[model samples]
Structure formats: C-alpha cells, structure tokens
Target: MVKAKQINVNNLPISILDINEDDYFCLTHMTKNQQEGSKIIEKWLTNKNTIEFLGVWEQLNNPNFNSHEFGGIMSEAGTNRFYLSVKQWVERTKAMGITARTGKYGGTYAHKDIAFNFGLYISPLFNLLLIKEFQRLKEIENNQYGLEWNVKRILSKANYHIQTDAINNYIIPTLNYSQKKEWIYADEADLLNIVLFGCTAKQWRDANPERSLNGENIRDIASINELTILSNIESLNSTLIKNNVDKKNRFKILLETVQEQRRTLDNIDFIKSMK
Candidate 1:
C-alpha cells in the first residue's frame, strides 16, 4: 500500500504519496485553490509541450512505457478535438510518472519531477514555495531517522558492556585460560550473534567481504529493529549467565527469545518506520 504524507505549500496543503520509494505529489491539490479544479490539469495534459515532457520522462524512468501509444497521443496534442485525463494517459501509455488515485486521498498525483514542472506551470512563486517546503519535510525526516538509528546503536553498545560484565563476574572465573582469556568474551558474543543472526562475526565477515573490507561488521550495518533485538537478547543473555545457565541452554533460550521478539517487532509500524 502507498503511504500518504502532506506538506503545506504557501498555506495550501498538497498531498504526497510514497509510490514504490518515489514521491508523487497531488496535482489536484495543487490546483484546488484555483477557480478550475481538475480542468487546469486537463488543460495542462493537452498541451503539446506537456505531452512531450511526460513522454520523455516516462521513456527515461519507465521501461514498460508504450512509446507507440505515446506517439499516437503526442500527434493529437493541442488540437481542438483532443482531450486527455490522467487516467487515460496512464492507461494508454503505461506511464509511471503520474497516477490517478481514488479514495480519501484521491487525486491526480505526478512524480516529483512532473509535479515540480506543474508547480512552475501554476506560478514560479508557488513552485518555489512547494520545493522549499518539500525539502524542509525531507530534512526533518532525515534528522529523525538519524537520531533514532544512533539511539538504537548506542543502546546496543551499552547492553553489550552489561553482558561482558556478567561474563567477567561469572563465566570468566570458571574458565582455565590465563593470558588469553579474551576468547571467553568472544565466545559469549558469538553465542548471542549466532542465536539472533544465525552466523558468527567471522562467518558474516567471510560471507560479506566487501562490507568487511570497508570495516563494517555485522552489527554496524544492522537495521534499527535488529539492533533493538540485539540489545534485548544481550541483556537477557547476561541475566542468564548470572543465573549460571549453561552455554547450550542459554543459546536455546536466546534463540527462542530472538525469534519471538523479531516476530513481535516486525508487526509494529513504529519500529518499521525507524528502519
């Protein structure tokens, strides 16, 4: 399903849809303040230059675009008898740059490239305001995304330390290693890694040589959801270690916890947004 968002361009609310990772702005909303609602869009679609612009855009971005049909439409543009709608254009040309959506947010939405051009057609001032407002919205979203990602990464690190502390206090005492006891910490970390990711650090690095070459480890590139889950399992594994649970039993419990938490988090929209 497409996600809808809105931005107020000079006090006029314009809707935007997330269509397959591309933003499509509501052309209907852009013309709503005018005397003519959709007629403006209809007029714009009949312009020969507009048809050419759309044809070129579709050719560049949509491999499925029917150039044969577009050529036929282009030839009739600007004629007294010629008329076109957003739906007709899409149906005839297999266009991806614009769509006619129905429902609560129903409108003629065009890809940002086309929408900006339409904004320019409306007025240079309106186009400027729309671009500025859209960029501001994107900046806010980017800032929020970065903030949450850093928070999750930091939380995972803090919990990792807590788990290591448990290893030092409990697990390390029973181990026989004298000078090279660091393997104990590595083993415990790998236990959590294996349970959650189904791979050890070395195994993951081996499988992803390019990422490894760039100095990014498995956790470094994990999604916000995965980091949250890793933090949870780390804390839980520490508790299990303090309770003197054997490594094998702890692995089983951590594995089960990882599976359950993933299933739960996967369904949460808020968590999905963070990613």
Candidate 2:
C-alpha cells in the first residue's frame, strides 16, 4: 500500500504521494486565487507550447504515461463550456502525477521537477519567485548539514585517543601471548570510534595529539543524525575487522558509501519536534 505524508512548503501543506518504496510524487491543488489560477490553467491547456512542454516532460520522467489518452484530453482542452480537473486528468490519461483535492489546505503542488514547469505556466515572474525561495531554503539547509557533519567529525576524532588508550591499558594485557597474536584487540567503544571517525583512537592521537588527546582546540559535538550514521558505521566496521579485513581499505570503502538510506537522514523531520 502507498503511504501518504503531509509536508509544509512555504506555509502551504503538500501531500507526499508515495506509490512504493521508490516511486512517489507530491500532490496539492491549484492556488485559491481563482481568477488567476483559472486563467493560468486555461492558457496552459490551450497553448500549443504547453502541450509540447507536457509531452517532453512525460517522455523523460513518466514510464507509464499514456500519450494516446493525453491526446484526447488536449483535443478537448479549450471549449467554452468544457471543464478540467486534476482528477479528470489522472483518471482519463493515467497522468501518474497531478494536483488534486479541495478545501482550505488545498492548492496545486507537483513533484519538485514538475512543479517548476507548472510555475512557468502560471507566470514567468511566479516561476522566478518560487525558484528563488526554494534555492534560498536549500542553501540554509546545506549550511546546517555541513556544520553538523563537521561537528561529528571533531567529536569522533577527540574520542579516538581515549578509546585507544583504553584498549592498550585494558584489552591488550588480557590477550594470550602467541607468535601470530601480536595485534591489539579493539573494544566496542574503539570500534564505534573507528566507524564515526574513520580511524582508531591510537591512530588519531598519533596524528593529532594536541587535539584528540590533549583536548585543546577540539572540534564541535555531533548532531543526532550524524551520531546515528556513526553508530551504524561502527557496527559494520566491527564485523569487518573481526574478519581480518585491512583497516585502511575498510576506511576507504566506508568513505565511498552514499548517504541515500532514507529521507530521515536528509530531511529535518526527525528533529522538528524538538524545535
């Protein structure tokens, strides 16, 4: 079953229509400014330019787009008594994505990619304004993300030396003396440190003794989201190390991993309640 979520964009609530784990789109109704909205949609429906624009978009993004059905809709787009609704477009043409519904919280919204096109149809000025606002929001979000990441990086670095010293003082002494057992045994905390910081405690201290060990000029603390990623990384790294994989290679592999696990990581929804 598809799960739907309501999200706020520029004070407007939009529904996130998820068809599956991967397939989804945003849906909202057209704006309430009736005269302006109708004029915009009417012009869009009748203009040859609008038809061509929709055609190109469907070709590129919609795998299940029904071109024959859409042709019928386009043919009847501009009659004196004719009417069109978002539901009609979806039902008739299997448009796959369109704005629908009614009431105070309703207005048209589209998938991020398609919304820009709709904005252009409304007015070039509207499109420009929307783009500007969205870009500004994105910049603010990116700056916050960068700050959080750097903070986590510093925390992990500082804890490295402490973890390494613990391992050397506590773990190493407990190991059996065997000819091939010259390696140091890592504790859970050390492993977690490795996952988050991409280095062992001893390694970090050796590389930056002044900061990791001495605690002077240490980096900022991590955000909750970063801590979660670090925790997962540590668990995975622990398993890899137990299997005797090379530490340097494991660090390189983890660095190459993408952060596309879910929207929970990229979006601010998780921490919104705290605010």
Q: How many backbone collisions does model 1 have? A: 0
User: Per-residue lDDT tens digits of candidate 2, residues 170-249?
Assistant: 44455545342334534445444555555666676677766765563212344556665664555455455545566577
Instruction: Give me the displacement of residue 166 in model 1, in angstroms.
Output: 1.0
lDDT of 1 by residue, 1-275 (tens): 78888899768999999999899999999998878877899888888999999999999999999999999998898778999988899999999999987888888899999999999888899999999999998998878767777898899999999999998888767765655458888888899888878899999999999999999998998876788899999999989999999988998898899999999987765634645
- Best by TM-score, which number? 1
For model 1, the superposed segments whose C-alpha errors exceed 4 Å read 206-215, 271-275
Top lDDT hit: 1
Clashing pairs in 1: none
